[model samples]
Target: MSAALLAALTATTPAAAAPPHWTIAPSAGGGSRPAAQDGRPYIYAEGAPGSVLEDKVAVTNPSAEPLTVAVRGAGAPDVRTKAKGPGAWLTFATRSVKIPARTRAEIPFTVTVPAGATPGDHPGAIVASGGGRTSGISVHLRVSGPTLSALTVEHVRVEGGDRIAYEVVNRGNTTLTPRLAVRADGLFGGVLDKGPRTLPVELPPGRRVRLTEPWHGAPALDAVDVKVTVTAGGGAGDSATATARFVPWGPLGGALAVLAGGAFAAYASVRRRRRKGPGPGTGNPRSAP
Candidate 1:
């Protein structure tokens, strides 16, 4: 074989494509630096209504090629469109930026809290998109004002014969971690007593979540009254009740049939005694009169 043909057959295969060499993070200590400080994963801000707060996000390009990134707000309260929440209150100094190879760009942004905004945590995120990939840093903005922790339990009911389902709503201005208690009273006595336990849910203001609790020990034959009580810190609490009936018609029907037969037999015995009247040991009531 020729040397040229042998060399062509030994060529290496093409390699897979590489991922983008860029990152986005919260600016270090609100400084002009492009890297984040340790233990500072998200941007935090606090202000009262009608106040303006500022923050920065850093986008770094470590590759040898220059990168252009498009920045915007995401998640709840985004300001990019007509929406409510902290995202809507944010405004960026520039929506697009170009960083040279091995450089970082720090973009500034402002959050303007409306005068009528409620007091509580309004979470949002700043996102940067480049090279078909995206990165984001969270923004935790808490408004200063009177905070209330209140909730409501609604639509309580039994589901699938083995679970209790209900809806919990946060009616206060602050977020709530609710604790739930379930109880059931039957015709005889208390049949279900589930003590209070912390629910794996985070209820934000004006949000309602539907959740279910396992009721594997539900009564097999009873008309039960179920109640769900939800409480959270900051004086938030509510209760709701529903009724469920679980009857085994197979057994109940047989019992009813036996009782009917016994009543008929007792009636026949009483009639026979009335017709026979007095015996030899006793006088007749009609003859004495």
Candidate 2:
């Protein structure tokens, strides 16, 4: 029922060569921010679903002329889009403010997470609009909930030196620490059986990471099928398979040459024996005697 106050990390709107000393930062204290908060250039908050977190965004104008800034809240912007993601959840105290030259104005705001929000990170921002230019600080909100680990291994291929390459995708709504195991089978049986090896990764939801596994000593000549299996602590599991063929061309070629030479020698011996048989009445010695 009660809204708890959060001390914000601080950031200042970059001073342009033009005007409006507009600097935006989170309120650190009564009038001054603590040194710890000074290192934080952005606003970071943690809360559960349906919880309201309150903070302030300070706007300072040190320009010689009075500045009237229009405040607006926008969702966090992404590389593919600006003003995207859960920005509507933010509410500001005042929509607009007129600040005298060389003065700073602090605008209070509250961010309320929806009850149905997924347990993960949601980005947003508080913007001050003036002279067609808008600047603000980033807010990162982490919603706490049940942690689920889901992972998938894909696009598996064997590179040089028995190195296995594959991609891991996180399909669930939680961050996962994943480990990988590699197994390869040849015409006879298992050629490469690599035990489960822990990978250095913290995969977040909806992200795919490419990783590789080293199979130190692979069979020289074999038609092998390789599989990569990924698993995490919270029951996350997935596997992908691929095939590769390895041959020792030098050894194979030498074996073929030796067989050909032996066949030629046997054929010559048979022809010589047939030509000499009963050629010159050699077996009719009785008539000549």
Candidate 3:
């Protein structure tokens, strides 16, 4: 064979390749539930230890060959995990589980937050690995314990008339029933009125409710200081205070009217003096007689 022919044949032939192309992607399925993806998944439950929280994890097969994935638990000592059928059941230590590729399966996992685990938030992550590819995802767990009801007055503003509208928000994850108390103070820092009013509201986590306090005898006040205190379910221990400005339109208008009248009177008096003939015959000294 000629050297050119041999070189051409060798170049035309295909070379040995590496392993099959494999990739991992997160997904969610089952019922109307929303799945976590892009490195974050949200799991919600209200129970004691050994309680299972079921969630779906998705695995995709982009390669020509089928791949088997392993879903595993990772993170802090208070969490655990195990595979539940196509998915995984995470116990106290189970944070994550895996699913197979090319078939796209949903894995169910249970999170058993140990007893006495801080009533606030416990953070952990679940990892899925297969076909020489691996990715880790985080799980947000909120533990519930004794109800610590708290209330916060997020915003306060005075509208038309003697009405004061306030926005109260419950920053805690639990529901809260709030009772609000509002006090109006003059610019000199003197309390104008104080009363006990019940503002019933069942606000969920990160929710806000508006309350209006109409002062039946609020004297016309312009730019007065206001202080608001909120108590959850009449609990004094969990209260919040906020201060704002209260401007009354009626008083402001009256002040503006008085200023305008003064300006008008001054202008009219100057015009009348100019029109009168320089004090009863005191004519312009520069004019010809």
Residue 5's lDDT in candidate 2:
10
TM-score for each candidate, following the candidate numbering: 0.71, 0.51, 0.40
For residues 1-289, write the lDDT of model 1, one tens digit per residue.
1123223432333446564568887777472223443736777778998999888888889999889988877545422223487767779999999999999898999988888777776666666777666666766777898888888999998987899999998888776889999999999999999899998877667777899999987888999999999999998999999999998777998999999999999999999999998788787446565
TM-score of 3: 0.40
lDDT of 2 by residue, 143-187 (tens): 788766677888999998468899998877655778888889999
The whole-model C-alpha lDDT of candidate 1 against the native structure comes to 0.79
Tens-digit per-residue lDDT, 1-289, candidate 3: 1122223322322336543344333344521245455442433444544454545555566565666666665544422122221112254223333333345555655665554454533444556655554554544555666544555775676666467778876555444556666777666666556565666554544456677877666555445666777776435324334344555667788999999999999999999988874685576567578
Give me the overall lDDT of model 2: 0.72
**For each candidate, what is the lDDT?**
0.79, 0.72, 0.52
By TM-score rank, best first, the candidates go 1, 2, 3
Q: What clash count goes with each model?
A: 6, 3, 15
Which whole-number lDDT from 0 to 100 does residue 234 have in model 1? Answer: 91
What ranking of all candidate models by lDDT puts the best one first?
1, 2, 3
- Candidate 3 local Cα displacement, residue 45, angstroms: 10
| Candidate 1 positional error at 240, Å | 1.1
